[model samples]
Target: MSSPRISVILPCYNEESYIANAIESVLNQSFTDFELIIVNDGSADNTLSIINGFEDSRIRVIDQENLGPGASRNNAMRIARGEYMMFLDGDDWYREDALEIAYREITQKDCDLTFYQMINYDDETGDIYENDWFNLTTLDELDGKVFGPEETPGSIFDLSVGVCQKIYKSSFLRKINAEFPEGIFFEDMPFFYYVYLKAKRISIIKEHLYFRRKHDASITHVVDGKFLDTVPAGQVLMRIFIENEWYEMYKFDLLAYKINGPRFALRYIEEKYKIALYELIKKDYTEIKSSQYYSDFLENLGPVKKKFFLDIIASRNYQDFIKLNS
Candidate 1:
């Protein structure tokens, strides 16, 4: 078998119920020039057996002890041979033409990365809703525009932190050593941020090419101490931006992100650790506000966000800040 043009990496962990459907979606893609790398992260269930049931030569399975999804992806990436790489979680599946559309746009536009939209599928309700991060109605206007952070800061910076929504050029990823932070809960935060910074040309397809499954068993839905990983993830992203001088270029977006990141922790973190997480975010905010580019951030904020910022700065306690923001 010749090397495929695209590589789809699916990392599984105890997903026996959905693993077969996910694999079948890839196999059934209209675009056939691809390989599916399935990394089973020590599923204590029947996930491994289901994966073994697929006899297609294009499917390569790597079974390892549970090392988390980030490590599993890194392991698959090392042996990936495709020109472009994409990720799919074990519980999630893709549209049949997803690879075909993404491949066409990326190859035709000659972009380093291509981000397509997704649909959120409610497991219990069986209802689907468009992922409206871009608020775009049609793909006709912005289908093949090749631009990066400098030209399209909002699009680049405001993208969801899920790596599954985008397809990356394998060479570009290898060039920047953009591997996920192993054993981290919010690894996508740092990984996708680094990719956006290093990407030279990015394209967007407004079409919904991926489906995200939202369920109680999903990692992001569970409440645990690991949720606090966002603090360190934010710090790692900030350090990378500062060290590479990207902070100044995208200061406004970064500022908004810094202020809002703690809100996610507040929502998901356990009550006892809330104050510590707030303090950590506040410390980062202090350093960011002290930067020379902070004035630029202030000037860019609208009245509402500006007032929120002032309230945050003036509040003496986390509860007051949350109340003011709320």
Candidate 2:
């Protein structure tokens, strides 16, 4: 068979309840020239069974021991045969025309990546929230808005880092060796960060092309030791910036992201792990502060944010910082 126009990588773990719908959504897409690579990361539930129920020739299932989403995606990419690639969680469904529109736009412009909008779907209440963060509206407004690191340095940082809601050229990813770090939570941030830096041209499409299901089982809703992976993920991002010598150019954004790690731990981590996580945060913060870019990042912050950062740095106490921010 000839290579498909797009490869949709859907990684699943214990998603029996939603995996069927997810697979059905892709199979029913208006665009048919795509391969749906479903990676079952050792799901204990009926996820595999549901995936097997799909008899479509385009659907390819890979069953393996649980290695987490990062590893599953990496494995899928190794075998993917498509001109472009897109990611979709096993619990989320795409709009019927999502692949059709994204494929058309990205191919027409010959861009490295194409980012579209997505709706946040609340499964409990069946409420759909439109994306307002980017304020994207009309096709004409988003058309031909191609940006690169040199043309608009900050624009890459502004775009959402979610691997979903975006389609990437297979060649671009392969050329840069963009692979997710296995066993790490929040791997999307670092992976997307690397892609943004390497991509020569990126285009934006204003249409909402995906439905991101919000549920308790999702990573953002679960609280556990794995949340600590955010620290290492941030570290990987910083290391990438330093290694690429892009630290000086994106220091402020990187610093903010690093600081947000501890802030997030303080707010959401379970009490049992808070103390240990705090120490990890402190060590990372200290190392970041000693970097040459730290002072520059601080100096550029506005007065209010600067004071807040100083207070947190000086306090060195998670509770105290929380109280001050609260």
Predicted structure 2, TM vs. truth: 0.89
User: Taking the tens digit of each residue's C-alpha lDDT, what string does model 2 give over 177-227?
Assistant: 999988988899889889888888888887889898989877777777878
Q: Candidate 1, after superposition: displacement of residue 101 in Å?
A: 1.4
What local lDDT does model 1 show for residue 260?
A: 59
Candidate 1 clash pair list = none
- Candidate 1 TM-score versus the reference: 0.83
Global Cα lDDT for candidate 1: 0.82
Candidate 2: RMSD to truth: 2.8
Candidate RMSDs in Å, in order, are 3.6, 2.8
Give the alpha carbon lDDT tens digit for every residue of 139-189 in model 1. 335566887756655555556778898999999999988898888777888
User: How high is the lDDT of residue 246 in model 1?
Assistant: 84
Candidate 1 runs further than 4 Å off = 134-141, 272-326
Instruction: Tally clashes: model 1.
Output: 0
